[model samples]
Target: MALNLFSRKQAEAPPAIEAATLRSDRFRLERQSDWQRLESIVTALEKNRPGRIADDDLLELPVLYRKAASSLAVARETSLDAATLAYLESLVRRAWFQVYGPRTGFLRWLRSFFGGGWSAAVRDLWLDICIALAVMVAGTLVGWLLVAGDNEWYYRLVPDSMAGGRHPGASPEMLAQSLEGTEGAEGLTVFAASLFSNNSGVCILAFALGFAFGIPTLLLLVHNMAMLGAMLWLFHQGGLGFDFAAWLSVHGTTELFAILLAGAAGLHIGRSMAFPGELSIMDAAAASGRRAAVVMVGCVLMLVIAGLLEGYARQLVQTSEARLTIGLVMLAFWLAYFLLMPRRAMGAKVDPA
Candidate 1:
């Protein structure tokens, strides 16, 4: 009797296992169509390309996503096969990202960046800016003293290509004529193009070389300031210092500020890398890069304005008083925009990376 009972129980075990397998198979077959539909919708949304989905699919996406989430919950409770549970969980997670992830249009991003992002970034890098300015000022003082001691030092500091016929030996009359645009239309065009190109290169280099501990950026700033000082000294010897000052001021205000900002951006990155504090070096660097990039974009825009002023206003606006007025007005406008503009609270949400 015991042996017969054992045989019967063993025979019943196979049918019970078969029944459980059939039930799971039925469950999967019943839900497979919905799962596939949900997956297709999610894939389309994830890719973010236009025209891959139909209008009805768009409407059905949220509905199907919810259904998938429900199915996942039911699967977990009922102890469905691991493979089916995993697919549902992954599909739901992906759909969740599409539904709730950061969403900013390009125009909105531009508005936010120009409206407040750039100024905020500049404000945050105040220490770096002051350091950069100090370096430039120190360079200027050195160049001026060097040139005063020896006229030949001007040649060493100021390249001939950059000097553009204005040097220590240039007569006052020649300096005045040069300022009056006696160089003709073609010459003015060429001069403006050359100036913009040269300055742009310097600005780019200052920002690009910050990764090397900011040493190169400092040197570039000093070199730029030295050239300015040498040029100023040259004009002073020719008794045209005031005139040259006014001429340069028209665009130099904007141009110099842009270059300084670029240097500050580079210095920010270098500082973050060197002194990462509690954060990992990579994390700190990434945060600093984002902030610096905002400032650099504004720097480029400033350079464009400077180029326009130099190319057009400096050439045509002959009177020193008019040029000074334009320069001062522009300086004031930029100062107000950057320093006085209303800002959001520090805790307010900012744009996502």
Candidate 2:
């Protein structure tokens, strides 16, 4: 083609194509299984072909990233490595970061946590409570079957020491002396409250451990359950069964319930990993972790309140009727506020008061 001297010839730069990164340089497949996994992911992604990153798509990244990483390794070792494959790896990573990376603000975190207030927590807690009841029923039935029929199995579910019964070897006077010796009159209330409060914290730790290590959290729960079972069994065996039940009812209603909540939280974390649904294990865990922290914090506050009641009020009062009455009141309050209120009164409204 000839251009006339008066005509301006248009010169256009070639259209820019984004440089493709070579994943082979960064990752290599060490196993055949990894290669197979990558193939599966790539095939699935190509099949589904969502145009852009959405929450639904973001949820799937954990599974995709793991698959792609494994595949990348295999591709590096085999003939599968290429520019297009590298592009796919970058997309998987981008999706991964979207699910887990920190968001913009405090409100974002709060919304992530408790946009629904105690309602969500209570929903989770109720599920846990149902499980706890099942465990208690099973444990109680087993205890009754093992121990003499004369022994009340409820005592086997809750111990005398926790319920406020005398030790077998130690006389009432001796236990009284021991209780008195644990703290001075000046600080005894505070000490007992703090002690019960922190003891409840062990449940929180057990629940939190599910995040770091999945099913192992159950071991912590079982341990606590065993302690409760053993104590109840021993008290019933000692003929102080009724008294023990009455005693535990005071603070045990709250403290033991908190432990159940903890166990539920731990179980939630464990199950998130076990059955991650569309999410990868890591992403599922991260999402579960946010909800779990909120629950665990609530558990801690319950423990503190229980500790104050157990230490200062429960131990010192020593009047079975009074203790039972007070325990019932606190239990009623919790049930009303946490369980009932969330359902009936508190919906989407956030209380500024």
Candidate 3:
């Protein structure tokens, strides 16, 4: 009789523990259908297949999420099974990401960036742009004066490889020929590649060197302008100044503007770091960097367009008037796009809804 009583007591102890487990199982069973349905709807939405879910179910998502949240709180208090709790938590997390995360697709982002972001960034940093232009002008004046005073300065300011046999000593006929694309098809290809590569390198260097507080970027801009001045002076001495000007105007307008924008971008970062104003240095730099990057992206595209003009139009368009017209048109287009376009209002919020 004692042994039977002991056995009965042990069995009864299990029933007490099992009763709590039974309640938990019953609770889950009652809610499992709803949970599974919510999970399916969320999964479809997450997979970007919202069409698979009915409109009524879509409307019910918020309600379902709220119920699950309440159930989670109750489950925690009641000491629900770990598996059930984990599944609920995971479901809630996935649903939250679908509801609140960034929904902008690539095409939308691209449109926004090109439509307004680039021009707005440029406008915001207008001060830096002005500074860059000033530096370039100063450099150009210095270079022109130096070469005019001494013909030897031409050799020093312009690289022999870049001048490509056209220098201060070249005769008027030679200089005119140089402007008229005397190079053959293969040579023109090589020249185009070299010009694009060199210009692109300058733009990249200007932007990259901004971290040095902008000094290097300024120097680079000045150097580039000096080269332009030297070349112009050389052609002037040979009596090809007018023709060269027209030829350069075709591509120089776009190319030089791109470089200027790049220099502005670099200087933006440098100035922000040097004078952070109210913000901390890190915060200022971060803000300025984002704005500058947008400008630089547009600048690179401008350079590509300039390269095409230089390579094809400069070679094919024989008349100086035609070249000048093309250059002026491109310059006007860029000016209107960047300067005249209406900008987004400051502190305007991007609607993610």
The parts of candidate 2 lying over 4 Å away from their true place are: 1-116, 136-185, 212-214, 343-353
Residue-wise lDDT of candidate 1 within 62-156, one digit each (tens)?
78878888988988998865566777788888877666554567787777776777788888899999999999899888888899999899989
Superior candidate under lDDT, 1 versus 3: 3
Candidate 1 ranges with C-alpha deviation above 4 Å: 1-102, 182-193, 344-353
Worst 10 residues of 1 by lDDT: 344-353
Which 10 residues in a row give candidate 3 its minimum summed lDDT? 344-353
TM-score, predicted candidate 3 vs. hidden true structure: 0.72
Give Cα distance to truth, residue 269, candidate 3, Å.
Answer: 0.4
Q: Which candidate has the top score in lDDT?
A: 3
Count of backbone clashes for each model? 0, 12, 0
Q: Which stretches of candidate 3 lie over 4 Å from their true place?
A: 1-102, 182-190, 344-353
In the range 1-353, model 3's lDDT, one tens digit per residue, is 22233334434555657776567667777887777778889889878899999999898887787787778888889987566677778877776666555566778766777677778989998999999999999999888998889978888888878888888777888878788853345466676777788789989999989988899999998888888899888887887778888999989999999999999999999999999999999888888887888888888888888887888889888899988999999999999999877675222232232
lDDT against the true structure, per candidate, is: 0.80, 0.58, 0.82
Candidate 2 residue-wise lDDT, 81-140, digit = tens: 344355446544543444344434666555544444554665755655576556655655
lDDT of 2 at 139: 51
